[model samples]
Target: MSSFHIYGHRGSSGTHPENTLLSFQAAHKAGAQGIELDVQLTKDLVPVVIHDERLERTTNGIGFVKDFLYEDLVRLDAGHSFSSRFQGNSIPSLKSVLEWITSNSLMLNIELKNGRFPYDHLETKVLELLTHYHLYDRTIISSFNHYSIQRLTQNGCKVETAILLMEKLVEPWDYLQQVGANSIHIECGAIDEYFITNTHKRGIPVRAFTVNDPYQIAALKKAGCSAIFTDFPLVAMQSI
Candidate 1:
């Protein structure tokens, strides 16, 4: 398709409370075909949807997320900004997100938040959760951690995997192919026509992240990006 598919990066974060159920619903309302979110493991190793390592920025809780168990993390108010609009909204589990995605027929980009502490079973757990929700085909699991993506790919999981990056490389597609990834999504600041065309020539889809600028978003489109991730889904729809 010539029109690039739009995804709500953390669920239309510009309009609604970010990473909250309300945000996902708002993203859907904004005509986003896909929803992208980050996943981190709690102390109990329960996969919870969040971005940062600490809860202080988005929630009422203090301290690193590694210090808290899944039970405690989910109890904290995740809808701090839109408290009135989404009272009692808490950090959701992968299972919950999977259910929501499947129920709404939304494509999903599942980004694995990398961290220390001997992360085991993270790839398996994510695959299992997606399988439990019957979303193997509709979801794309992505990460900057190459090993994590390799693990998921080796497990015979049917989901697509994308390599995420920030910096520019001389041969971007060759670099990604070395890691066995067929898709690459880079930060908007680092994307260029050469990078896009090189990646497309390798039979890999190129996407740009967090692009909100109308002119820059148009540039990414002209560069042959298969999709674009943005916090303002409505603005993206308007542009694309």
Candidate 2:
């Protein structure tokens, strides 16, 4: 149980603005070993750290992330909606985030946001960024889009890849193997003893997402999960 890792979901999102550098720093301060963030491409092809294809929810901007140029995206306030304390937080570029993570000696789980926007060459762009930073050894790239996962594998990325699943599969491990994924990221509701046991049988670990409650964390830990992705990593660290 002590071996389980705590990954900051959207980088301490419960407290700070999700995907902002401040949020990531807060997660690291909370003692999270890894940070999980989403990436989407701007109209000008720059990769930025953000969760949604649409900007309204996360930033004080209108329209889809792909519709905005990189320069314009930078002008939006990503933190104000969260609170006054984080008023000017800007959306971070993947490059910036990578540098921060490298300096802090933290692991990263980059979830490609291509599932919703289908940005052209998103996988390749992300791979290039990881390679530029020499972060493959410490990064796990995941996506709900199995095609994106396959693309990364086919491109010969050595970074660990995981398939994100929101529902139960008849044979989750088999699907993971077929997709060439090294691990699985299952939604908390989809986790069960059967899935965990079979994944462990195959020697691959499972990760749970959006887990915050102490009881839920304890249950997932008891079920032998590899890690828990939490918006409240501070609370998670304290609870465990």
Candidate 3:
């Protein structure tokens, strides 16, 4: 197996505000090779980097994110909730994140949060932005909504796509073939050495999510995981 990649979950979320540009920058500075973030379409169809459908958890604002326009969403204090030091930091658009990413060599994992509301044209809009930035080669689009994954593949998406799984599936490689996904991004607890080795034999890579414990990180690396998403990129990097 090759060296396992470490991706900051929501950009070093353990120390910084989740999904804000500050967190992303911290992740890069912490020696993370990649960053994983979530994408949700605003009311006007602009793609923004955030993990929740509701705004109260991560921002000073209240209500659903889909109910607000990008102009309004950008004004919210996205960083204050995490710490007073991050006060006045605004929410970042996917375009802004892409612009920042252009200066670095970090691999991007964009997880679409459309399972609840099923935002229209979300797959198309995200693809457009990735194309505009010419980042398809280094980007991986994954979603818990398998329909969205299928849609991207059916529309002939050029970049790699991974199906996000929360539970163990029987013969997941067959499901990957059915969905036209290149890999799997599954919950950490659901994956083991046998699953990773079997999936590797089928030419499918397994990337675990939200892994924080040093022992689990090292174990996954030894198990031949392609990558791991963690809130503490620096700690994860040190583990292996």
Q: List model 2 lDDT by residue over 209-237, tens digit each.
A: 98999899988988899999999999999
Please say which candidate is ahead in lDDT: 2 or 3.
3
Q: Which one is best on lDDT?
A: 3
- 18-67 per-residue lDDT for model 3 (tens digits): 99999999999999999999999999999999999999989999999999
lDDT of each: 0.82, 0.91, 0.94
lDDT (0-100) at residue 178 of candidate 1?
Answer: 72
TM-score, candidate 3, is: 0.98
Model 2 C-alpha lDDT versus the unseen true structure: 0.91
Model 3: residue 190 alpha-carbon error in angstroms: 0.4
Q: Highest TM-score among the candidates is held by which one?
A: 3
